[model samples]
Target: MTHGNTSWQEFGQTFVDQSRELNQKVTDEILERTERALVSAKEKIKQTEEVNEILKLRVEKAEQEARDVKALLSRPMREIAEISGDFQKAYEQQQQILANWILSQKAYRETAVQLGIAVGKTAEEVQDLVTQNANAVLENRTEHGNDSNTNPLVKEYASTILAIRKKNGEV
Candidate 1:
C-alpha cells in the first residue's frame, strides 16, 4: 500500500506541472499576436493620413482652375482676342524698350563716372550722383501726371531720360 501511494503522488505532481507549462505557452502566443495587430493598425492609420492630405490639395487646385475658367468664359470673344493680341505686341515692344533703356543708362553712368574722375571726385561720389538722379527722375514723373505703363520703373526710367536731356539743354 505504501508503494502504491508513492506512485499516485508522483502522477499528481506530473499533471500539475504539465498544466502550468501549457498555460505559459498560450499566454506568450496571445501577447505576440496582439503586438503584431497593434503595429498593423498604426501603419494603416499613417497611410490614411497621407491620403487625406493629398485629397485636400487636389480639391484646392480644382477650385482655382474652375475660377480661372469662369473668368475666361465671362469675357467677350472679340475683346479677349484683341486683348491677347495687344498683350503680345506690347510685351515685345516692352522688351525692346527695356534693352534700349539699359544701354542708354549704361552710357550715361559711364559718362558721369568719367566726368567725376576728371574732377578728382571719389567713386562713392559718382555713385551718389547716379542714385540721386534716379530718385529725382522717379519723383519728377509722379509730379507730371504722364504715366502710361503700370510699371513704376518704366515711368522712372523714362523720366530719367527726359531729365538728362533737359539738363543737357536738349529737351
Candidate 2:
C-alpha cells in the first residue's frame, strides 16, 4: 500500500510541472506576437505622417504658382487701364481749353486776305490744327511709351480691349 501511494504522488507532481511549462510557453509566444503587432502599427502611423507632410507642401506650392499665373495673366489689362486713364485726362483738358477759346471768339471781315501766313496754314485751319496738336501733345506726354504705330501686336491688343469695352458699355 505504501509503494502504490508513493507512485500516485509522483505521477501527480509530474503532471503539474508539465502543465506549468506549457502555460509559460504559450504566454511567451503571445507576448512576442503582441510586440511585433505594436511595431507594425507604429511604422504605418509614421508613414502616414510623412505622406501628409509631403502633400501639404505640394498644395502650398500649387497655391503660390496659381497666384503667380493670375498676376501674369492680368498684366496686360492693368497696362491698358493706365493708358485709358491718361487718354481720359487729356480729353478732359482739351475740352476745358475749347470752352475757353469759344468764350473769346472774334468776328473777322469777309476779305480772305491775311497779312501774315505761316508757311501753308491759315487761321481757318482750326480743325486740322486741333487734331495735329492734340496728337503731338499726347505723343509728348507718353514719350516713354511703345510708340510703334505699326506694331501689329499693340494694335490688336488695343483694338480687342476697346471693342470689349464698347460691347460692355464701358467705353
Candidate 3:
C-alpha cells in the first residue's frame, strides 16, 4: 500500500508537469502570433500613411492647377476689357480728326470757288492752281510724312499759290 501510494504521487507529479509545459507552449505560440500580427499591422499602417501623403500632394497640385486655369481665363477677359476702353478712345480721336478734316476741306473749296477774277485770273486757271496746291500738301503729309523728300515743283507751286492768296487778301 505504501509503494502504491508513492507510485500514484509520482504519476500525479508527472501529469502536473506535462500540463504546465503544454500551457507554457500554448502561451508562447499565442505570444508569437500576436507579435507577428502587430508587426503586420504596423507595416500596413506605414504603407497607408505613405499612400495618404502621396494623395494629399496630388490633391494640392490639382487644386493649384485649377486656380491657375481660373486665373488664365480671367486674365484674358481683363486684358480685353482694358483694350476695349483704349479702342473706344482711339475711335473717338479718329472721329474728331475726320470732322476737322471735313471742315478744312469745305473751307478750302469755298475759298477756291470765290478766289479772284480781279487778280487777272480766269476761273479755270484759279481751279488748276488750287488743285496743284492741294496735291503738294497731300504729298508732304501722306505715306512719306512731312520730313520726306517732297517734289520741288509741287512745293514751289504751293508757295506761289500761298503768295497769290496772301497778296489778293484771299488768304
Candidate 4:
C-alpha cells in the first residue's frame, strides 16, 4: 500500500508540471501576436498622416487659383469701339504733326534758297549749310529736350540773311 501511494503522488506531480508548461507556451504566443498587431497599427497611422499632409497642400493650391480667377473676373473690360476710337484719335494727331512738319520744312527750303540767291551762294552750298544746321539741332535736341522748334543757330542765320537781303534792297 505504501508503494502504490508513492506512485500515485509522482503521477500527480507530473500532470501539474505539464499543465504549467502548456500555459507558458500559450502565453508566449499571445504576447507575440499582440506585439505584431501594435506594429501594424502604428504603420497605418503614419501612412494616414502622410496622406493628410498631401491633401492639405492640394487644397491650398486649389483655393489660391480660385482667388486669382475671381480677381480677373471682377475687373472692368474695355469695349472694342472705345479702343478703336482711341486709336483713331492718336492716328489723327500724328498725321497733323506730320503735316505741320512738312509745311515748315518746305518754307525753310524756299527761304534758304532766297537767302542763297541774295548772298551769291550756290544751291549746293546752301543745301550743305542747311544739312549741317539740321544735324546740330538734332544732336542738341537728343542730348537735352525737344521742346523747341527752332535753335539759336537757325535764328542767327535767319537774322543774318534778313539783314543781308535788306542791305541789298532785295527784301
Choose the strongest candidate by lDDT: 1
Residue pairs whose backbone atoms clash in candidate 1? none
Candidate 4 error regions (>4 Å): 1-6, 77-171
- Writing each residue's lDDT as its tens digit, candidate 1 over 1-171 gives 235556756777778888889888888898899999999999999998999899999999999989986787588654455657765576667668889999998998899899999999887899876665655544554345534244666665776676775687543
For residues 19-121, could you state the per-residue lDDT of candidate 4 as single tens digits?
8998999998999999999899999999999999999999999999899767654654333224457656766776788899999989989999889979999
Ordered list by TM-score, greatest first = 3, 2, 1, 4
Query: Where in model 3 is the C-alpha error above 4 Å?
Result: 1-6, 77-171
User: Model 1 segments beyond 4 Å from truth?
Assistant: 1-6, 78-171
Candidate 4 whole-model C-alpha lDDT, 0 to 1: 0.71
How does each model score on lDDT? 0.74, 0.62, 0.72, 0.71
lDDT of 2: 0.62
Residue 9, candidate 1: how far off, in angstroms?
A: 3.9
Q: How many clashing pairs per prediction, in order? A: 0, 0, 0, 0
> After best superposition, candidate 4 residue 146: deviation in angstroms?
55
Q: Mind giving the per-residue lDDT tens digits that candidate 3 earns over 1-171?
A: 345557767888888999999999999999999999999999999999999999999999999999976775566544544556765676667678889989998897767667646577787887776655555464455433532236565566766665675677654
**Lowest-lDDT window of 10 residues in candidate 2?**
107-116
Across 20-139, the per-residue lDDT of candidate 2 in tens digits comes to 899899999999999999999999999999999999999999999999867755676445445567655766676688777665532222122242243455656644444344344333
User: By the lDDT metric, which is better: model 3 or model 4?
Assistant: 3
